[model samples]
Target: MTVLVVTNDFPPRQGGIENFVRSLCDELPEVVVYTSREPRDAAYDATLPFPVVRDRTSMLLPTARITKRAVQLLQEHGADRVLFGAAAPLGLMGPALRRAGARRIVGLTHGHETWWAGVPGTRQALRKIAEAADTLTTVSSWCEDQIRPALSPAAAQRVRRLTPGVNTRRFAPNCGGEQVRKGLGLEGVPVVACVSRLIRRKGQDTLIKAWPLVQESVPDAKLLLVGGGPDRQYLEELAVRTGVSQDVVFTGPVPWAEIPPYVDAAEVFAVPCRTRRFGLEPEALGIATLEASAAGKPVVVGDSGGAPDTVRHGETGYLVDPYNPVAVGVRIADLLSNPQHCKELGAAGRQWVTEEWSWTRSGAVLRELLDV
Candidate 1:
């Protein structure tokens, strides 16, 4: 059961989908990948076990050359399953893959397909692809709900939920964050860490706004803002205006290999993501929250997107208003104050992730989906 994968999101980029696609490929034996990035240029290419075909086109979208080559690969390998790593890519090469003897045509619908569907042209094309594909899977319930209306009744029936998974062995309760703390100069302090790209939708500003209130409750507590984005300068300015500059530490864009230590550095992990529709940028199956939980840390997230699926409200972590700095502050303060409760919640999260959300489990589901 050879499988051919078409995807724009691949290594040399850092993201949830990129990691998920790679993990899925790692699970299957007969899989080949095609990507927009060239193999010679990417640093992570050598790390992958499967073969990959690189496109030479300058166009952002899939080109005719890619389509022809994909069909060639499918027919040549006798590949029965052709999995489009994303919904958008299917619009380009789906017809060719079907004609080339692909028994299973599958597309993965992440959160942003909902944003693309808002456009009249893209919406119709997405629907056509949905109707054509054998199945379409979503990483989050929010994404599944967002895409359902755009799909035909028959295509909608094929929709399935497959949330992103965490590598529990790599990210666990006993993993030490001494390096993360030493690098960020947050030694011997109660840290509230937020690990995500510092963007408007991720609600880093809301967390910064809530820092002063958090300070009054736990004065020595530090807000460790990890990851890089356009919001860095603005967030720094806001911290200055709010006069919590010394307390907020920014480690811009840590590498994927180093993410676990950052998670381990925190007593509480927070991702106060807000609902953004213009780009449809919801949390959509938060791998970070799961990673934090795996590392035995209590999580604090907003009510939007797939966050609720990861954090079990009061059981694992608190769900607060992403826009409300006061609420964010209060939750952090509560977690910081109660060491025993924090340990309890963190243990609960670790146990849950260990039992339920592992790459091994996700791989089994993906194999079942491809019927391989």
Candidate 2:
């Protein structure tokens, strides 16, 4: 049975969820993708192996029209199995698709559904989606804990864990970092890199706030802020305000394929993510941090939600209180100051990731869940 992948989060729009969904697609036996429109999507889709159906709308809501389109795709592709990339609202269309002859429906939840599990109205909506889907996949155990309780006992039992995988070969040590450093004129500088959307919850501001302390310990250290988001202006202004503007390099919106070189360009990687919205929005599982670890760089991740699940503190990396800039700075500085310690931690991370977190392992679990 061909799997029909449905989601709003897909390339050529760049983000964690987009990359997660796209990577999972390669694992499926036969698949057809139905996602919202993106600029340069035609060029992107043309490069893909399977068919990609773009919606007129840029974002899809589970309205009657959206449901109709999804059902039509299922029938056209003869896809008995349907996979909703980020679950929640998209998974709401499962019932409609089932009525149209879909056998199995899997809804993958990142961190957002954990929040959906809390609020009253959205919690009901989440439960409904959970009931509709044959299996609900959570990216982390913490995420599974947050979302499962909100479902009915039967639906809760169907919840499973299927985290994203890292391509170890693609993100390895010396994978074009020297060239990236040369291009940026950052050759031989001790760099702390954060690769994610420059959003408040992802904590670029906290990284900036912590920069002065990092600089005190390693005065020649530079901050490499990658990816673009709404918070770009705010983060830039905050960097200037913190007096780390000259040392901070913003590589706005790097291509997905080019991310590895940038990841390799850092001495240490950090993302001080925090829970916001009264503990609603949290970092689900930081793919970037895992990528950095895969690149043989020690990571400093935030102690937010599922983020801590990504790092083995002091062994692979350090987990700091996201709200505490001093704590974040200290960890980054410690790694920067001690080259041997950093190398040891990074080597441990690389070994751990190679043994555990590979696309083959993730794909096998997903295949079992989909049973396709």
Best by lDDT: 2
Clashing pairs in 1: none
How many pairs collide in each candidate, listed in order?
0, 0
What tens digits encode model 2's per-residue C-alpha lDDT throughout 1-372? 899999999999998899999999999999999999998999999999999999999999999998999999999989999999989889989889999998889999998899899999999999999999999999988999999999999999999889889999999999999999999989989999999988899999999999999989999999999899999999999989999999999999999999999999999999999999889888899989999999999999999999988899989999999899998998899889999999999999999888888889999999998897
Which candidate wins on TM-score?
A: 2
lDDT of 1 by residue, 242-308 (tens): 9998988999998788788889999999989988865467777778998999999999998887778
Query: What is candidate 2's CA lDDT for residue 52?
Result: 98
TM-score of 2: 0.98
Cα-lDDT of candidate 2: 0.93
Question: Please, what is the TM-score per model?
Answer: 0.95, 0.98
TM-score, prediction 1: 0.95
Candidate 2 clash pair list: none
